[model samples]
Target: MVAQEQKSSHVFDLLVVGGGVNGAGIARDASGRGASVLLVEQDDLANYTSSSSTKLIHGGLRYLEYYEFRLVREALIERDRLLAIAPHIMWPLRFVLPHSKLVRPAWMLRAGLFLYDHLAPHMKLPKSRGIDLRNHSAGKPLKSEYSKAFVYSDGWVEDSRLVVLNAMDAAARGADIRVRTRLAAAKRVDGVWEAQIEDKRSGETSTVRARAVVNAAGPWVARLLSDELAVPHSKSVRLVKGSHIVVPRVFEGPQCYIFQNPDKRIVFAIPYERKFTLIGTTDEAWGEAPGRVEISPEEVSYLCESVNRYFEKPVSPSDVVWSYAGLRPLYDDAAANASAVTRDYVLDLDTTGGAPLLSIFGGKITTYRKLAEHAIEKLIPEMPVLAGQSWTADAALPGGDLGVGGFEAALKRLRDAAPFLSLTHAWRLTRAYGSRAYDVVGAAGTLEDMGENFGADLTAREVDYLIDNEWAVTAEDVLWRRSKLGLHMTQEQRTKVERYIADRQH
Candidate 1:
């Protein structure tokens, strides 16, 4: 057993250093397994690479080419599990892939999709099917020259909300979640580890002692390993920068398009936030620091060109409403091409160095839960009394207890209770809050009871609930993570919210 280095007021079984999907998911899982957990984030939850992902809960069909069957199958299985558990936030979307004889032969696409269908346990999701693009609704917005299409199913997640929900769930299970609490330094004292946490807003510093520390800091994994843990290692992480563009919705229906580019890379044009089409992503090797990740004009042009090749409605730079870029903290496999770098995660457990420090290398949002399970399993040998069973796969998130009447039933309940609420507002409330929407809205019989309407589907009541419950410290945290109202809110509305938060700090 590791002896205590010094007396500390706050001591936990596990201390997680990142608030992205993996860190949040691990915190939630660890707390649920009866471990005292503390999760500290330098920024808001999902403020970094997690929110910047393409936001698909996919099995990685393309990974088939790399023969990553284990990863693909595990991810495929997790997709159905997440859909059943978080129906309000995640759902199945069909991707139409127009056949290009030059890129991939039809048979290869068919076989991959077939393996994806069979690899996972069949849930509510349907299998893939080949389609004649000329006759299908999916191809209505595609060029007439593309005749054949392959349609497959995968889950889509509201990326930031997913991170928030996981954090909320972890909090509910008694995890101490501290946002804007940056990890300044960590050192092993005797047999226990002590870490200094600095509150970004208060500018105050505190110390936390923990038996085990988890380095789940996404792109900053190596930095934490070297600078904080002071571990001497020579491992490098390949940072691949990916960018996405949001354009006006070109198709009439909910279907998304997957185009095969001449470079043998794929791009997705998904129906986003109802009125926008989300297209992405370019794989470029990034030497820039992770904190400086941003969309380049060249990458934006490449995305537009790729989409224009298959779709009837050609997109230009002017058509873009929003653009985002993130650095994928991939395991440095020394691959010749950036796109070919492995997406699978690697864990370096340093147990022999007085105290244990587990550093996570690479991972995706889709497989966060399973990754947490594996992480916990790795630590069990060190702490033999720890429980071995996994509990997250069947567990519901904070608001996920409501059965799969899907999002509609929750929305209907909200509307029926508050007859005065607008359809748009009610739907947004239900979708964002799930079964717990009423808990915040309360028995408000009228709009006045719900408090001030800030902007677009946002209200004072919701903002208050977020700050009180989800650790929303800033205006950007509220608009982006707790909700997507920032996209629809005007500058004046956002400024008002910012002012309100600033005033509250004093």
Candidate 2:
């Protein structure tokens, strides 16, 4: 960590505001190119929109209909690159899209899949194909009327961990990362950006200087510009709330389903954490603050109804074990319907009177790396000291260097080396930390050496690693973001973990 005094005293090449995927990616990219960077987040990493995604590294299949060919093609290509870099956190998943003659015609579906397949022609993932649902394993859980389905491949991600990984890589590359630090104000002074940042935990405020600023505040982008920097941007963001619900496993297979709703939106039911089914996402206009966004009663009903349309068994609000909502800061294009808004990002570079401030509007996780590369390209003319060329394209994120052995082979090696660990526990560690799992499991020959088990295989040693390395302070950061142990733990167990974190802080 960069010392507080040093952070305030030194002038950085870039000051990245917001610790979501975009900001983290930019910090990592800039630091890799030899630019001095400091990134500040107002809350825990991925505590907002980044953690609340549907957890897919997918090319927006539906976006093709909106004529967003460029975005789809870019995302499709990125899917392969992400899979190669972080095989543990990201992998290919087959999506079962049941055909509804009453809705989209068979020809239209086929045409869309064909375009999707050819868009990224070199992608090694399986091509889309029609399946006989009556005889397929995916069919057994669906309604009897659905006899045919379309299966296509996309990627799933550990959403919050992805953000943490990028931040980790950035820090490793010499970028200063500060979580729970809020940007209070900024002004152009003597051809540089002078900013005041407040640490939310300690109530300490400090001033930092930077050659440039990046507003990757996700939902708070526009507000940060107007309120903190007092700069007006011609582009505005539309906050659309998307909600997801988790219930007990609804199907027997590993495959996920993409169901078409009567309202023309789609919802996904994916296998989650080996014990639950994840279903989601309703797009609705939101005017509320982005922090701590919650799923509405109506959204719960909407998700349940959407899944029930295809699944044999129905689910209701009572069946939902967990639900979360996030606000997407989409670039406002004056589209009439919330669902019609484009997912493409727009970068506004403000060099109005003095130092430059780059504001990012609307971006999905699938294309964050490319977005960062583009951001650096735009800033290079102003900041010529930024090293030549983009380097993140082939670089591996922290703990993602599994070599040619790959994730499965790495998992086998982990279990083999840690004979004392149960298969489930070892698997969990491998999935969460990749090659760095050994670092967490270090020298412990027995379960007793792991220290205080709060529940669901969560131990003190793992928590310490998160605290010391990943900037995890609260139990919620451990249970929810760094890992999903909360879903498996009881309230008493959670309370115990919370107390453990509190005790360690003292």
Predicted model with the maximum TM-score: 2
* Per-prediction TM-score: 0.96, 0.98
lDDT of 2 by residue, 1-506 (tens): 34353245689999999999999999999999889999999999998999999999999999998999999999999999998888889989999999987779889999999999999769889999999999989899999999999999999999999999999999998999999999999999899999999898887789999999999999999999999999986789999999999999988878999999877899999999999999988999998776778899999999999989898999888999998889999999999999999999999999976688999999999999999999998888889877577888888887788866788798889888888888899989988999999989888989899998999999999999999999999999999999999999999999999999999999
* RMSD in Å for all candidates: 3.3, 2.1
Candidate 1 — worst ten consecutive residues by lDDT sum? Answer: 1-10
Alpha-carbon local distance difference test for all models: 0.85, 0.92
- Model 1 has an lDDT value of 0.85
Quick one: best lDDT, which candidate? 2
